[model samples]
Target: MSSAVATVPGAEHAGVSLLRGDGVITSYTPSSSTVSEVDRLQSTYREGPCVTALWDQHTVVVDDLVAEADRWPRFAPEAAARGILSMLSFQLFTRDDSLGALNLYSSVRKRFDLDSQMLGGLFASQAALVLAGAQESVRLHRALATRDVIGQAKGILIERFGVDAETAFTMLVHSSQNTNLKLVDVARWLVQGRDRPVSS
Candidate 1:
């Protein structure tokens, strides 16, 4: 993400973040304290060009945060207070399953013009590919971890209750459905419970 954003023509301070479905920032590049704070404010307040781009699944260009009061009522004022006069945000990946956004900020108003916008778009496309690879890696890691934990949980159930593998799995599923929790959470709970010190 950092490398992809670095090549942009005039982007002085750039940041990339992976946002969750509910608009929570999961991962981010701390380009600088100021840029980091700006990104934080956006996520904390749930308003900003980045947040808008994520929701609308399109590039959001704010030539001047001070002049964009009507667009982002809360964010524009706060961003201006932080000396962020201009910003450009591009949604990484497609609208259907957007991962997050790549954002560029400037202290000068109207800093991101037509040429800058074009370069930013090109940079964003490259960033999307990198983000997709990173997301897939995370997904694969989580899947493997879930599988391991579930296996451990099934083993514990089998040993403790003298049940077969299928029965142990069924018990886990039943617990999951009853508690309205994910199978992974249920399995994790079972494993943790098994590892706890037994009371006399």
Candidate 2:
């Protein structure tokens, strides 16, 4: 994905960053020294075009870093020091459950024009699709694991208390609610607890 953006006419550097639902940057790609520095600054200070793009769910274009000093107090100066004169950040994905950004940087001001924005946006959409697919795969895997653990927990309850399946499930649910933990967590606890010897 970074390579795709790097091919843009005036693009000097490009990076794709994934942000967790809480707005913390989780991962980024194509490790260039300067680009990695910029990514780190944004994640550390929590300000920059990329951060804005992720939060607002839109593209953020900076024509000149020097001119945008007030907008991003700490980021603008640091980015300029690294010879980044301009940047374009597209919101790669923004859903209730996910967020991500694709950022392009250049040494010359106004490097990304309309055509570049459109092409970058297209790339961003592709990134979004990939992120969404990956997230879904993770969700499905967790769901399967949860089901397996919960089933084991239910079986244990049934054998120990001589209860029906529905009653055993209810017990799990009650435990989950009482502890304020997820049903899956509660079920996992029950399964692991069996390994411990009962106290005399």
Candidate 3:
């Protein structure tokens, strides 16, 4: 965001909008509190340059928010009142899904030009790639941790019940189903219990 504010012409503030796992769009890495408030307005109104860029178009450029009030009836007036006159947004995406948008805000009318768009687009693309890689790494790490805990649970079950690996796994599945809990939860419970010291 700091890089964007420094490099993008007329950009006073910058922010990343991301689609959360729960299907909500949220502001991330906002350059200032003003950017965060503007993003909140976008979420509340659901009609802004960032929303349009994320869902309908690859990019959105608003030269004058006051003049464009009709386009985004609820959001424009509110944003303009906050002293944000011009805005630029570029859709951020990966090969598999639409990630979110990169947004630039300016207090001057007609602040962003074609040059700004070009430079911001390049930055947005790089941001998308970095975000995608970070998300994938988190997923891989979570999967590995889950596997390790489940393996430990299986080992405990096999030793205590004098059963084979397959039987131990089946027992875990049955416990999960009977308790209406996630398989991982059941495995975690068993593993945690095994580590607790017995009462005298």
**Most lDDT-accurate candidate:** 3
Each prediction's RMSD to truth:
3.8, 3.1, 3.7
Q: Which candidate would rank higher by lDDT, 1 or 3? A: 3
Using lDDT, rank the candidates from best to worst: 3, 2, 1
Backbone clash total, candidate 3: 0
lDDT of each: 0.79, 0.82, 0.87
Model 3, 1-200: lDDT tens digits are 89999989999999998756555668889999999999999887888999898878999999999998789999999999999999999998733433589999999999999999999999999988887788789889999999998899889888887889988888888877787888888888888785542111
Clashes of 1: 0
Candidate 1 lDDT by residue in tens digits, 1-200: 45534666556678876676655764477577777888888878878888888778578878889988887788889989988998888888643444678898888888888888888998888878877888789889999999999999889888988889999898889888887889888899889885642111
| Rank by TM-score (best first) | 3, 2, 1
Query: What residue pairs clash in candidate 1, if any at all?
Result: none
* Span of ten consecutive residues with least summed lDDT in model 2: 191-200
Better of 1 and 2 by lDDT: 2
Q: What TM-score against the true fold does each predicted structure earn?
A: 0.81, 0.84, 0.88
Error of 3 at 157 (Å): 1.4
lDDT of 2 by residue, 31-64 (tens): 3667788888888888999889988749998999
lDDT of 1: 0.79
Q: In model 3, which regions exceed 4 Å deviation?
A: 94-98, 194-200
